[model samples]
Target: MKGNDHLITAKAPGKLYIAGEYAVVETGYPSIIVALDQFVTVEISRSKSFGSIVSKQYREDSVFWRRQGDQMILDNRDNTFNYIISAIRLTEEYAQTLGRRMAVYDLRVNSDLDSPNGKKYGLGSSAAVTVATVKALCEFYQIPLTKSKLFKLSAIAHLDVQGNGSLGDVAASVYGGWIAYQSFDRNWLMAAHRQQSLTELVDQPWPNLTITQLTPPENLRLIIGWTGSPASTSHLVDKVAISKSRQHETYNQFLIDSKRCLNDLIDGFKNGSLSTIQAGIQKNREILKRLADFSKVQIETPTLKKMCDIAVAHSAAAKSSGAGGGDCGIVVIDKNQNIKSLIKRWEENGITRLSLRVHPVIDLAKETK
Candidate 1:
């Protein structure tokens, strides 16, 4: 794709939240997120035809295409196709503003995330696709969109697809680091603050960490367990927002406790305090239970609770990582524990487990071209 001067390619990966899920929607709370090894890739090439952007999807050796300016169409078959259109439309608008000639292009998008049985692992695959598509368009059209700007643009695209959403997921996918996100009211005051301060916040360098010097921990494992049911994070978040607007004391208390748990986890990671980290996970689970009604009927299921109980029985600290309902759970194992044996035990119980180890946060804008 690179050999063709007119074509451009870019890729961005999905992400998992290390901490701060529902709490991030609050004004003062901060969220921590990291990009996963899994990614979605986009390739864009010039088309000789004018005013005709053609979009394609590639999955499992199958390919399909859709034409631009047609009725707003969404292929129920391909999730990545929706985001490709968003990226192209955003890129085209920006190009128009710069007085650049608009040329039709062919876009090819591929995703590594699995979609079997209509099940998703809640790993931010949609955000990854949006970021990758935007990056490809920025490169292909020679439009200068900074990482933060790209993140903001991708958030708009996300809202177009999902109705309403926090940009934290897209920010994590693009920036690839521990991010502290605060959802400000989209009022003039908050918008002004965002416009004035976002760049500075993103530009600030990550703190130095001693973990980079040590060999990645062999026993440190993350087990992502899926609950077959799916829940809408946007709806849950909006409900919570409405509850907050009504000044519900119970909801406000949950937010406070969530923030406290998140801060403790961040501090634990900083000091390498495994005990504190485990304690924070435990507290976070408790807070989730207290706020059960916010999530409607999607509280952690009996099966997931039993799994967490088993992990705890084995001395492993576990908690739900994303919007609670039935998405996924993250378990952090101790350094001295045998992760393989633990995973085997999980599999015996019909729980799927994936190994994930934490790494130093990478600043993508500075680290990559």
Candidate 2:
């Protein structure tokens, strides 16, 4: 595979939710997300007979696929490669619309978002992989995809497989760095996809969707701690949606409060106020706790509680990351704040501290080529 005359490689970074968890799913509601240094990379090279996909994360379960008219037909029903397969199908369709030639290619995927033992860190691998695949294929076909186009295509592919997600992670993967993101109206996009060309659908402005890069305060220090337990974000989100349907009034208020809290947090970033940012995180944590009690869902486990408490005790702000029934907890402190004791306490309670920094944004002028 390495000896191929032309090999196109692309990597997309993993992400963590800084704030606005359950609320961000709704159209127009915003959340803060940061792309981490870890990534999922995809490599594509010409294949003689048929296209195949191999993922290091999936071990022995490789997928053999071929084109059936305009569709990708996988040899097996293994769901592990659904995200990658969907990306290939959508990107190829888009390429065909632009009169770009399509051909068989062998695709390889590698990820650094999970542990060596295959334990997930809940770092949004699916989103990263989908983004990387779209990026790689666009380059392979010489499509000259922009970052925004890359994001739109990746989101469509991911949603086609997963069926649901706020797609904040998709935005982070495409844009990189810290961003304030609001999800677009998925219903509208689906409707437009049926009526418009793939190229037209991607170029049009998505209703209510916005992604803005944020500049963190100079003194900010983000700390990530893994609880050694993986959580299913889709399952947790499904349960919350069910509870929300039964308790509309309570859920509505949660949305309102969450929007206000995150606004302050975004403002803190704009004003370079570390104290305001910490306060906003503290408030959001309390709001999530109330939401959990009413919905009877455990967004924060006992282990996560211990982690947050330790951070608060040390004068920092902490909360469960993503849809946390388990997995990672995030803490925000001033760079000047002494956190050695806070880390010691977390280690004593069996939490593993993760050393991850923010991935910077890509220059769109250079990236599009």
- Pick the TM-score winner: 2
Tens-place lDDT digits, model 1, residues 1-369: 222356576877776765667777554576566666766777777766432233333444332334455322333454445665776666556555566565556666666654554467677878888888877776666766676567666765665677555556787677664454554433432344346543342243322210111122344555676655566677776766675666578777887888888777777766767777778778888887777765353556765786677788888888776676666677777867766666666677767775443434545454335
lDDT (CA) per prediction: 0.62, 0.92
* Cα TM-score per model: 0.78, 0.97
lDDT of 2 by residue, 1-369 (tens): 123348878899999999999999999988999999999999999988798899987867899988776667788776588899889989999999999777888999999999999999999999999999999888888887788899999999999988877999999999999999999999998899899999998998999999999999999999999999999999989989999999999999999999999999999999999999999999999999988998899999999999999999999999999998999999999899788999999999999999999999866556534
- Cα RMSDs of all predictions? 5.7, 2.0
Q: Which candidate has the highest lDDT of all?
A: 2
Clashes of each: 0, 0
Scored by Cα lDDT, where does model 1 land?
0.62
**What TM value does model 1 have?**
0.78
Q: How far in Å is the alpha carbon of 279 misplaced in model 1? A: 1.4
